[model samples]
Target: MNTKTIKSVRLSFLLVGMAFLLNSCFNSAKKTETTEEKAKVYPSDVIPIMEQFSILCGDGTSFKDLIKKEHKDFFYVTNDGVTDWVVYKTPNSGITSRTSSNTRTELGQTETWTPEEGGKLTGTLKVQHVSTSGDARVAASYSVVVGQIHGKEGHENEPLKIFYKKFPGHKKGSVFWNYEINTAGDDNSGRWDFSTAVWGYDMSVVGTSPDTYPAEPEEGIALGEEFSYEINVYEGIMYLTFKSKGHETKTFTKNLLKSDFSTKEAIPQQIWDLYAAIGRDGVERENAYAGEIQNFKQGAYNQTNGKNPEENIVWYTGSETYNGDIEKQYANGCYAEVWFKDASIGPGSAPNKQ
Candidate 1:
């Protein structure tokens, strides 16, 4: 053979070898990229995988329910149609894997996940499908964390000390004052008391007849009578006393901490009016007016009364003694009193007549 022919043949062989090597490298790279993308984790896919574990619950048992009952402080739920477990650990604590003996096996294969101090537990569940093709399987997994609970002090059966305040206004034609009582810490059965100064002024000062007033000074002021007073509070209890000429003297003790109290953002106008009207009367009158006032405040006014002004006032009236004229005057005065009371002292301890 000629030298040039030999050289051309050698070049041709080298070019073919180079092309084959390049094609092999390209195919290998493509396969690696496909594998990496498929391996990425997805929580939704994993949770459904964990539900397979629920198969263990077939024997009249629920693994999820059991976990919730055992550790109410720690629980997990998944929306991705997958199963997950989560755990939280306190500092300096460690978790140990539960053994077969530690888990109840009556239902099926189940495990108790534990956490260590400063450690967190997480679970991710997924399912696998076996293909008809021999030895071919598709699988997925999920992640979750476990939680820990701290114990609280006091036994469940221990009695709790309740504290409250009572604001018993004066009876009609009597002085006005506020009295408090505590049923938890001090004399639970003691009556409350205050001084004449705390009782403020007598209803007689306003042209009202004291003869119609309550036998006790704790009663509120009469209609058209207005008074204010301050009651002292020491610790949780209060001591009050009063004396009148030709009348029996009395002393009362009460604790404010034992009174039941709730806080509301606003007091309705009708409630304020009803409270004022009742305050002008005695506890008996107040109790009687409660239902009527509640109905009025709830906007359930009598239709017949709405047609006639006089009937309207009477129908709205909480007391039989209050006529249309008296009700109008009482309502106007009550607006002022209610605002003053609510602003200055807040909702005082008066029983919910309702």
Candidate 2:
């Protein structure tokens, strides 16, 4: 071959070798960059971003703005400078998120992304319902999870799972059965005095009075010895049901508003009657004998001492007869009593005297 042609061929071969070496170096650098990028995307880094993104979206913010405003803290740029991811740390809850690009084609196209930990981003949040008047408060926690990506537009799947837990507040009072029944005359002439120390005050028979009466003790009606009482703190409703010895039943309901001792009323009728007739004499009086009046009178006197005299009286006077076969149903009386603090009563007078 000619010298000129040979020289040209040698230069071409040298240039080709240089181009191959440069290409190899470029591929190696790219591989190294990919490895570093993968390492940066750990479960910790991705979890937080996902969580913030979810919260922002749930709060009605758009995905794009959510990242900018709420997830700014968790973002990190990829080694290639073309991709980013975000992280979030939920407060008293679990983690979650959304991504700027979740599709194969768009995955690395965005300046920022979320939920790098992969799998499904999931977590929980707590919410509270606080009463404006400081009378009540309730709290609940909810859990949620993000599933697969939707279409190429990068929309996320609907929350795949959810659950909730309720937290109840402490009750603020003591409940007592405050009435007595007189089997001797089948009369329900007494009062029950219940009180609670709550809302920075004492509520009891000494404070206010609610009135209730028992239905006439029905003949052949068996008395149910056991009864149930339910108090709803939220609604402030008290429910009482009495089962007679012969299976007869009676129920009464009272609103805390009307029965609260914060008012000036005497004891509620139900409570007054209960307190009057619940003792040994009230329950076991079979014969009309001497000294009974004194006992009854003394019982009444003891009820009214110094606290609140108006709440100590039992007003029913009646009688009924039942067949001996079944524990006789004494019907003919119904009474109730409720008491509330006067708002004027100082906190010092609220303790039990006994």
Candidate 3:
């Protein structure tokens, strides 16, 4: 309690008060910055689909943390001066997910189900662009897969690959759905796709050469057009319904538990015509994708890329690549763009027999 001791105590209190004041100012500044950031809304913020599924944005980034923020080269929001749409844009020749060679910026359903214990998935989207630099002879060239029903077990085959494709000289694009048959035996090489068209020729239809063009599909879809699909898997049977504004509404039913392509004679004529030359006439397993785990995915799954044209002429697109630069690819039409206005997922119900 001496004079010098009292002065020392007062100074210590003053120093402590100054330190606390500075800390408060720093915290306040940080809060203000965070509030400003939160003020800006994003597509995910308005849609909030991340509450159920995990998103893989374009540019190979996962939307686990920054779901509310837009990534310029990937997932973002855009309005056509009327309604907002979530755009999923991915380069045809850029970084992709670990499990896939093809680039995809999509939302994967966290849950998995089986054919007997069925599930449902649906998507309403328009493909704005697809790479136009692929080998014309190849079926998958210049195509983009918009939705998928990917199998998680037993060969990991994709049961459904919904595609939109337009060749170099075509005015309209074809919309088709392919079903990859589960191999009948240990040789996975026997797998093949049975594609059926919604509004145009199936995936089997292709030009005769890399530059030659086929006759335009009279009923095909065009760019900027909107379409929808419903995958109602009830009681192990897949009931598909597809609809568009000015196109015919199509409905299909397929048995997932049994193989329709078990014999050569059972193979569809389209498959024989498309795959016979490529040596891919394969039969499905007797017990097709019976007990395998499956899940749903929705987005722009860019099927075209920088793979060599001579490698696999069937699936390799041979798209333009500016040494793997994404910006350049986007400018040269080496990307896939899709916008979804509305989407949903839940239990599937019985299909109405029309």
Candidate 4:
């Protein structure tokens, strides 16, 4: 071939080779970027137990397929400089279940079991925040439910509700649990909850006035403090264990098949004072929660609401909701946030074995 023609052919081949090399490099870089994006962690990666549960958010969002998935601002993963945690957050007021006025970003167990069948749930978590603008006179103000044994049928009363509460400007807060009565009759409005303290006062403690707060708990939990709880229902009895660093480990037990308040005289005086205004004096059934189907719940069940506290002192938390504007409420400290480092659910074991 002629020298000039051969030179032109050589240049063409060189350009073709350069284009091929550039394309290959571009594809390799894109593949590396995709690999980095997929490296982002998720709540499911932290807690593989989510496969057996469904999630409900404060905005009325619900989902069951939680494998490697997360919802923004409600159910997601976060890191606190040391550990990765799954966060559940809810505003004081948002779209909620029909039977509840308060909102929640929580997990509901898909399986149901009777008291006799039993189950167990365990969690390691921390309370990040609670609604700061609530009436101190209200029992449920500035509080959130972290765990629960909730009924699935009949009146659907909760047998256990683990709570964390702190007053505005207080450095420490209280951890308590409540047992709601399964009312005897059809009228459920008269049912009441009996509370027991875990690390501090129970649900009955409240301020004397609307804005005034009581004394801060001397040995209570502070915001961002980590704790753990195990609820084991074995052979018709409920056993609870609460533990935290720098605090005493507390354990409690209650018979689930027998009624503690079957008769009118069995109601504690705290219930009389707390529920007298609302007239909720009904007693629990003789069998209590026996034979009832129940399931476990965990995460931030926000107890603060916008209802007037004077209407119902026990549950009506007159907290600022910003008219259900979640963004405004979160920005103004009118929300609840909880973070869980680990959790698990399974069949209940014997108390001795646990």
List candidate 3 stretches off by more than 4 Å. Answer: 1-39, 65-69
lDDT of 4 by residue, 80-103 (tens): 999999999999999988778989
lDDT of 2: 0.23
Q: After superposition, how far is residue 351 of candidate 1 from its true place, in Å?
A: 38
**In model 4, where do residues sit more than 4 Å from their true spots?**
1-22
Q: Arrange candidates by lDDT, highest first: which order? A: 4, 3, 2, 1
Which digits, one per residue and each the tens of the lDDT, describe model 2 over residues 1-354? 999999999999999999999999999999999998666553224333322222222112223322323332222222225323222211211121243211010011112212111121112111111111110110011111111112112122111111111111322211122212112343423212242211111122221122231222222211111122221111222233333243334444433223233222433453443344334222223221111110000000001101122322221111111211111221211111111110010011111220
Full ranking by TM-score: 4, 3, 2, 1
Of 3 and 4, which scores higher on lDDT?
A: 4
lDDT (tens digit, per residue) of candidate 1 on 1-354: 999999999999999999999999999998899898665433223233232222111012234333222122112222333323221101101121132111111111123211111111112111111001110010000000111111111110101111011111322323322221111222322212111222333211211221122243343323223222222223333333333333344444444334321112222333234233223211111111111100000000011111122222211212211222323422332111100110011112222210
Q: What is the lDDT of residue 179 in candidate 4?
A: 95
In candidate 2, stretches whose alpha carbon ends up further than 4 angstroms from where it belongs are 42-354
Q: CA lDDT of each candidate?
A: 0.22, 0.23, 0.82, 0.94
Task: Return whichever of 1 and 3 wins on lDDT.
Answer: 3
Winner by lDDT: 4
User: Which of the predicted structures, 3 or 4, would earn the higher TM-score when compared with the native?
Assistant: 4
Is candidate 1 or 2 superior in lDDT? 2
Measured on C-alpha atoms, candidate 3 has an lDDT of: 0.82
TM-score of 3: 0.86
Residue range with the least summed lDDT across 10 consecutive positions in model 1: 293-302
Candidate 4, after superposition: displacement of residue 133 in Å?
A: 0.7
